[model samples]
Target chain A: MRFAGRVAVSLYLLVVSLGLAVGQRSLEVCSGCEFTSLHAAVQQAAPGDRILVRGGVYREGRLLVDKPLSLLGENWPVLDGGGEVEILTITADDVQVRGFVFQNSGVSHIEDLAALKADNVSGCVVEGNRFSNNFFAIYLAGSEHCSVRNNEVTGAATSEAFSGNAIHLWNSSSIRVEGNHLSGHRDGIYLEFVQDSSVTDNISEDHLRYGLHFMFSSGNEFRRNTFQRSGAGVAVMYSKETVMVNNRFADNWGSAAYGLLLKEINDSTVADNTFFRNTVAIYSDGSNRIEVTGNEFLRNGHAVRLLATSMSMHFTHNTFTGNTFDVTTTTSRSYNDFAENYWDNYRGFDLDRDNIGDVPYRPVRLFSMTVENYPQTMILLRSPLEQFLDYAERLLPVFTPRAIEDDRPVIGKP
Target chain B: MNEAVKVMKYGFFDLLRSRWIFVYTVFFLLITGGLLTFGGDPNQAVLSALNLVLLVIPLVSLMLGLSYYYYTRDFVELILTQPVSRPAVFLGHYAGIALPLALSFLIGTGLPFAVYRAGNETDAPVVFSLLLAGLLVNLVFSALAFWIGLANEERVRALVIALGVWLGLTMVYDGLLMGFIVLMQSYPIERSLIALSLLNPIDLSRIVVLLQLDIAALLGYTGAVFQRFIGTAWGVAMSLSSLVVWIVLPLLLALRTFRRKDF
Candidate 1:
């Protein structure tokens, strides 16, 4: 019995010693340590170790991350690009880089180098970094399951010809973009051939061009985002199965500015979005099988403009209050359905008190028709004669698009 | 005539007597001259100089004008007790300030032009335009200071009102115009740009100078739209008219208010 007890004690001590050895394998890289530079520490670190880069200006070259390690930048260490190529390049999976400043990237129309570039990598996290004065801030291509959050990207865009996008994603899937502030670029975020992405809680403002642009991408969701004072708030083209919800589009006012522009999009849902003070709320061209419901259009120049090629878009349960023109359609036979929308200018009565209009509410004003023809007849808007003519058209329902009528108009503002 | 000459003379002497004015003038000349000499492109240099002058000249002029008005408030009161008309006294004081400021700006900006003329002849006209811009800015600020002085009795209130007017003219007016544009997006009020230009003094000034440069194309469709609606000559006339009104109307209102007030 004594010999058996001694053998158990020896085995327990050996196991405890092995556990401590495994715990000490993950090294710490502090600022005041022997390894001064981040690159140096990264080079010395093995896989699954932590490289803690403390705060200072690391005037370093492009840092290539080839190991599956955690590289954390404490206190926002600045990594100047030195007017060259990318600042950080990731080639490994499960890498995490946080809290760094990337600046002064070189301009090349052909190369398209970003401050942070990740290619063919997966399960990476990039958060809390400042990207300024660069051509492109973050560029992820052919990557999967990566998360980018809480980053600020600002560019001093002189002209459209020489500017680059703040964030560019190409052929990436299952990516998450959250809580970023992007401004002053050609486009705040650009996605091409990307799929199954989620972009939420982001503010993209004052861009030289579109705030958010995605082309040939599908199965994406954009929620709780704010696009303000941009040339165009958002543009989705040649994509399908997308959802845009609870976004605010404001102050995007120019001759060609729009809150949202959809081209060749099919089977998308744009609901619960608020568009205020944009030149046009939604400009749809060649888009079909889309549902626009429970949205608010306030103080927009034109709430909805459907071109000749657009078809089969359903508009229901939306509020059109204080819009200059509720709807504008080019074709004679509009295939779209407008049902159960509250039009502030609707004059039809519901005698049964069911809140549904007895007569169908024709939302397309005669002024919009005239503007479509003349384009400068917009100067006559708000004039006393124009108001009189609008009232007459509402009473008569002539010269407006016949199919573009809201069947059930709600009495109260939605 | 003698009394008018005497007032002008005293105004000149009053500005020259302040040691801070000399230091500021010398510093302005040195800094502007250094920047122009070290600048890379002549066009960029002129633009930078114009921007600096637009931002700094008005501020300096306002400070100088306020100090002069406050220091001479008692003298102005005593002068009001005398036989001279208030408008004439005001005009004489303005002429005194304007002459010295124009001289300083020309001299400070001219030396660089003379040096740059060895390689570039067009620098002369550009420098001249920038100097004129500086003078106009000074006039606007000085007139504003005079109006503030006449409008308010307390020195602190007068200074605060002057600063507030300056901030409104430069910074807050653009923000308010943008807000107005956003609120009225549905209305086809592009024609309202004409009336809007008439309200802001800085926009009027920008239109005048930008039209003179004939680079209105750089401002894109908005500039072309503005040019088509209001011709170059009409824009300049409107700007001059606005400047005259900015000077005269404020003084008139202040004069009436001063006459009716207890002070």
Candidate 2:
């Protein structure tokens, strides 16, 4: 009798869930409904149940979705955390959380709390969420095969240290992060130990720190993203097999600002990017085995500032115009390759009509090295004394790096 | 000619012993020396010195020209009666003040740069350009002041025009240029703007100093034409010669006016 009863209960549960999957039952969540809160609805519903949250302010501490349910908001339901914890926490696989407004996830010294925190979940969709006053907007940790898209996050961070990244992904694989607009965060998007992810068509600007802080992320591709007016634009550190293509970075001007800072990054491709009006467009520090091609640097202080530790870098088909110094380095010996780039400073004529100039273009200026060695000399910029010294150095290779030259310089803009 | 030489020799010696020359020389030495020592950067010192050249040099030149001419009016009349020609008195008196002004400027700026840039080969060009700029400013403005002095015998009008020219070149001209740029931003204003900056001596000297520094921020405004013009051996030749023209044109006018004036 006991065995028969257990079998009947199992069959009943299986049939109900299968019915929910085939024709999902809608659980209405509102003040008039039986389930007034999203948390209550989510708790009452089984796997594959759809919860329709109505438009109203829900003072929920943390709305946890433990089952594979679809929680959709109508007319943008507000989920306020009351300045304590994350608003939404998704711990189940195949969960969908969309069209919600999240606010007031309080700051913590040790714990990094977010508006929507998804952990160890796969095949989830978190989309069209508007987040404000949250420490972090969306944080995906130990999750894979998830998509975070079309989210707009504007965080309130008065101080740099108390803030968090807008879209923070860690230890994730095969995720799609796209079409997100982020501002006023420490970092727009930060990815660490993330693999095979694609971040595309995102606009990240006006942050206190970097727009995109990528570290220890491999085989990731970010394309057509606009990162402007951040502290240092984008910082890709200790990452390999990353491709940055067609990104626009501009107007990040400060004493130590760079449009794209590549530090200890290896086997990366920086292609077709536009860097305009930055203090330093591309600052490479101990980075190696990277291909920089078809990029445009305009009106930057120093378009490319390479360190002595950088090696095996190949830059080709790039256009450098209106930049103060196209390429500046601390060392006199070069370990990088720069060829087929168009430099406005190049004075050589293409007498053979081959499109390439006969004379090599030297991008590293002696004054750059002098300023690097003696930073105070920057104040003497454009003075007759400075110009004379640079002229003399260019005439005769005295102290400038003799090897840093573009041999196949294109005659015009490339 | 001998009487003119006697007058020039006496006037030169007299000005050399004056307290104003000592004060001017000491002022230059203090500023240049302070910049070289406390400014922390030779480039910074050069920039400050460029500003000094633009403002102080012109003022000093005009003052020296006006005061010396006013005080020596009776002497000039006496020399004219003592068989000295009009051109000789004008040329000798002009040289008497101009040479000493140039000398004081050279000593005042050159001393600091020499002491600071001693054996520092990299800084030599900076020092040379700075001193050259100062010396050129002295020559151009002093020569200009002599002409103004010759044209206008009245002290107030001469001083007003001198100050006016100085203000016009340094501040008002730049203001007008900036306004024009804003008004015609859509046009290809780079080439025309480069040409415009060349019309003013202050602007030209500033350009020379900027080209020397090779700093991207300041050089960015000059555009490609300026880069091509200021970055080569020919650019330096052209700019320095332009400075010469600034001196010669004004001096010739002053000499002509002085030669024709009936006292």
Error of 1 at A330 (Å): 1.8
* Alpha-carbon runs more than 4 Å astray in model 2: A1-23, B1-263
Candidate 1 lDDT over residue span A1-414, tens digit each: 999999999989888787566652445445577677778877887777777777777767888999888877777778898988688889999888887889988788888888888889999999888899998889999999999999999999878888889889999999999999999999988999989999999999999999999999999999999998987667889999999999998878765678999999999999999998777789999999999999999867778989989999999999987566789877778999999999877787989999888888888888678657544334334333345567788777778878888888898664
Please state the interface RMSD for every predicted structure, separated by commas.
14.2, 11.0
For residues A176-228, what per-residue lDDT tens digits would candidate 2 score against the true structure? 99999999999999999999999999999989889999899999999999999
Best by lDDT: 2
CAPRI rating of model 1: incorrect
DockQ of each: 0.02, 0.06
For candidate 1, give the lDDT of residue A111.
88
Q: Estimated TM-score per prediction?
A: 0.62, 0.64
For each candidate, the alpha-carbon lDDT, in order, equals: 0.76, 0.83
